[model samples]
Target: MARRGKKKGRPISGWLVLDKPVGMGSTEAVSKIKWLFQAEKAGHAGTLDPLASGMLPIALGEATKTVPYVQDGAKVYRFTVAWGEERSTDDLEGPVTKSSDQRPAEADVLLLMPKYTGVIMQTPPQFSAIKIAGERAYDLARDGATVDIPAREVEIGRLDLIDHNADRTIFEVECGKGTYVRSLARDMGRDLGCFGHIAELRRIEVEPFTQEDFVTIAELETARFGGQGDERSDSADTVPVDFDAIDALLVDTSAALDCLPQIAISDDAATKIRLGNPVIIRGRDAPVEAEEACATARGKLVAIGAIEQGMFKPKRVFAG
Candidate 1:
């Protein structure tokens, strides 16, 4: 098989849609997968809380450069909010700080959904990875220091009330980057005159990917070792990455740019791009439209570029 990148552990490059299990922090999951693949480098597009489970896109090697694209894409999450008790961390991790017996009627909850849709300001959970003065917010919170996280604007595409009972409600949300479901749940409860916190959370989709593309860690291990009958991950480490399987199980870097405008360039242009030289782009005797686009050569990604005066200037070049 052709090598896709230089090997720190091995020349692996692609994205893995992991159905991240609950209780495993995002960073820990990244490290475990990196160790499993013996990959040179790896990073997740977005962080899923330890209490949250489901689709976590793991980008490997050169694919890491495109993570911002995936992270900024629309995300779909299905979560459960249990009313009556407020937790310090916003989810189940923290101790109960406040409680109430009041619960909103189903109609009241439905009536409140519209207020959350569209653009809104959300305060992220204090027990979060966000940096504050060079240290993690969670670190400070765990150290018993008071941490006050500021609210920021975020866009919500859709919010659906999936199911509900006396003490809890299930909801599904489609939102953009920087939206915090934990904060949403907390605020919703507050608006309803009852305290609340996330009881269960799962990310069903991230833009360019859906639950249909998700793979569990065990399934990944099995695929790597050809999934020998009845064997599990304990024995997976003994087996090496099937170079043949890597291409099948892993998605290419181009998948990350699915939302970007695309412009195909000539081999000569691609060559010049790799050499850090600018080339004029032409589409059917006319200059390519748009200020930014992903440039490709012979169906393979070349670089992300900008157009100015009809010249395509490579901003970030991809190595073969």
Candidate 2:
């Protein structure tokens, strides 16, 4: 017999769309949520800089297993680029390294915006987490060592100039994973023949999750204690959380798997795949999705074989 008053065990799975406030690191937010829910497993998709704020999806329980799917999703951000100055950290947090006497008009920024769209080679800022020989580049830079990280290719699907004031310009960006908005601001300034840095940044969306689905830290804390009714706040600054909000943001791992061509299998084939075999993929399906499912199956996904003589012959198995 069970104890009458014993609390139920923690929920096995859920996704938290956090409207991260400024001044907290990504990991700190995850830790707080983990404590709040007492969840045994948790992880965030992409990391947001301490100076920035907005939608940060924290996966809990079995949802943590789907993080890679979310991580690979596209991101949208609204940021302010401050003209006439540049910073070491590429944001307001870093020391000013350069300043300009000239301020350009909105048209100048609009003209230069086109150059950033589409595929581009970008050199990440030195003050970044990118590793060089297993040592973080930022670590080396802070120690007064010179680190030259070669430029890599990244795609900027969309870059639009939203508004411009005398000293600051707001822009919206839709970019692939690994696209650094700080670096974009720095390079855009260079192209304009002026120095600049990101003054403010907020993620607007991360693929499936939008601004409408987010819940700020304050709201979350309030809800946890039942201080306020679970009604959605109407503040533009506040993202609402509801059933639809959760459903919209919660992307199943299989959706990512669907990106690849799927290979159907029999019970025997599934068992073989569970046993550990290299099943050759006939076409590109969601690699992360397949990998995730395989990991969930204790390292066995399914048996893959060629369809020959109107029959499926087991060729390779991805298994434990």
Candidate 3:
């Protein structure tokens, strides 16, 4: 077996997709994984609430440089919304401050689901990490200070009603990076003339990464000790885990380039772009017909350059 740090005492570099277990905060999980892998550097792409569990991309060493890329990817979640009651935290963990005398009918909820889909404005919960006046908003709220949080525009590509029970409504949501499903549920209750909060939340997917790709913490621990089974076994209980499993969960740092039309640069152009010089890009793939339109579109961390005259010059380079 090739020991991770056997060659030298230095840390190994790669990505790890942790099926973050419930209870541990995102920071805690990163710390444990870093120690287990003996990685010198590590960071998570996004924070998953301690109450929630699922895909968390842990970037190690050089991969940490790509964290920002994955942070912007679309996320999909499966959560349960409990009706007839609202809480300060907007989730089951919060204290209930209000309840309704009337129960919401299934039809009422189904009718209101469409309103949450697509682009919408959502005010984050007061008991959140969002900052206000240079301090965490939740910290202010906990100190008995009332703070008003402004609503921000977020895109919800899809919000589907998956199942419903008497008091719990199950939903699957696909939304942009910053969308808050808990706030969406709270607001949905408001729209329906009732109050509600999130009951159970589980992230089912993170754009390219899905539940199928996740590995439980127990499995990871076992893999670490070589006790649960072979570290590279092919059996269902001992399937080999590879660097790509972690890489697959990461939206390539250059994924934003996919949104734009690309031009295949000549070898000379590629070399000059790698060297860091700006060149006037023309021909197909250059910002030509839709220069303004392309500029307005969301940009990704990409390598851009072109060949002008006989010299290749580099243009803009995004974070990698």
Best by TM-score: 1
- The better candidate by lDDT, 1 or 3, is 1
Best-performing candidate as measured by lDDT: 1
Off by over 4 Å in 2: 1-11, 228-320
Per-residue accuracy of model 2 over 1-320 as CA lDDT, tens digit each: 96688444255355778899989999999987765554567789999999999989888766665577678888999999999898988899878989898787999998899889999999998889999999998899899787898999999999988899888999999999899999999998888878899999999898767777787766665555445534434441233343242333333433323333355444644554455543433334424223222322323234334443333344443323
For each candidate in turn, the TM-score is 0.91, 0.73, 0.75
lDDT of each candidate versus the true structure: 0.86, 0.72, 0.69
Model 3: which residue pairs collide? 256-300, 277-314
Tell me how far the alpha carbon of residue 191 in candidate 3 is from the true structure, in angstroms, after superposition.
2.2
For model 2 the local lDDT of residue 95 reads: 89
lDDT of 2 at 140: 92
How many clashing residue pairs are found in candidate 2?
9
Runs of candidate 1 with Cα error greater than 4 angstroms are 1-7, 228-241, 285-289
What is the RMSD of candidate 1?
4.1
Better of 1 and 2 by TM-score: 1
